[model samples]
Target: MDARFLGIPELAEAPSVAVVIDVMRAYTVAAWAFAQGAEKIVLAESLDDALALKARHPDWVALKDGPPAPGFDAVNSPGLLRSVDLGGRTVVQKTTAGTVGALAVKEASLVLCAGFVVAEATARILRSRGCDSVTFVVTGEDGRADEDLACAQYIARRTTETTTDATGFLRRAGASRAATELTEGVRRGAHPDDVALCLELDRFRFAMVATLEDELMVLRPHDVPSPTGTAAA
Candidate 1:
């Protein structure tokens, strides 16, 4: 199957199997948390919703939310996740784009979380599962384009779909001046440590699944890691 890029509205109409990318922090951090041993991650679209989930499952999971700069939980920093002992624990998080993007594509048959941090891993899983078609969902920020598209482009390159013309999107968004910024630069504005984490190609071996249980969207990481521990091809 070919790969295509779709916005939130288009995403709502696409087929079931799809890959969601929110690289700036949401999916990137989620991948980090899972790598650190987090059993699952509850994704909330709003800060209040995430906090409320914690209120209901205080003993069931941990909460992290707020602006991209990090809040009570220290922003969406993948670096920070690695330091914590998530072992068997779950994290309930809300992000500006990632969480909302994942929730937007809820109808997808296979809604896997993705970003530059885990692009290679995500693709390998999809290929192993015999997936040929993909629609990369990029969560727009406040109606404006965000770094999510960049992440999507990064992963889309590994799929059967033609390579994404990242420059085209950047030019269209008028963020061309920020071209030199790259992934690390974009991430630094939010969480420098996390930017570094997102750049680690194929650091993990497992893929993350966005699942829903009791009306809450959660991420469940696989037990086995990828053979190469690398990102998308």
Candidate 2:
């Protein structure tokens, strides 16, 4: 199997399997939301569409770009989602990177959203499926964020059975410009815990696979089997 680590700009040429990574917050938040019992997440390209969807389905939570709207349940923060009740609830997510990357690579044979949390499971899925080529789409700020790049590298290392300094990778990501921005936001009463959460590696065992359901991108947890033939849910 071959794996290519590219930025979001390379999504035009779809690969056999594309793994969209956004470690700063987007994919991390989605993984936490799913783990917390979110029924489904609908990826919206624009905040207007997200709002419109929220208007149509008032029960669903609308996650916008900036701060959480007054009537909305939560923002795009994994730390915030940790405290909210997402049981059986649907979320409409609109972000600058992760969601956009997932939607853009719809042409891929398989699209999966990943973060540090599910890196190993994602690698397992790729190996299990026997994919010839895998593309890791690092969806960062214009595709240059170090945190996302580090995550892509980590996943690639896991898939290819290579060794990387995991501790060094996390340390570098914590000091990245994106992480610094989020840390600054934390001082202003934003979710301070998200910075630490996003940097934690392999926190979850299930891969979040993106699939189209009724024209909406829905992310669901895919349990990967361990080497011993047991399912890792």
| Structural similarity to truth (TM-score) of each candidate | 0.75, 0.93
In the range 1-233, model 1's lDDT, one tens digit per residue, is 57777776665474677787765557778887877777788887777776666677765444453344322344566665667777887688776666777888776788888766566667666766777678778665532345566666656665544344444533332342222243335434344455456555557666778877877787887533445654422
Model 1 lDDT at residue 207:
70
lDDT of 2: 0.82
Tens-digit lDDT track of model 2 for 1-233 = 67777777766677778999998788889988888888788998788888888999999988855675665567788887888888999988888899988988877779989988888888888878878888888888767888988888887777767455577678778999888988887423258888999887878888888888888887777888987898886
Work out how many backbone clashes candidate 2 has. Answer: 0
What overall lDDT goes with each candidate model? Answer: 0.64, 0.82
Best-fitting candidate, scored by TM-score: 2
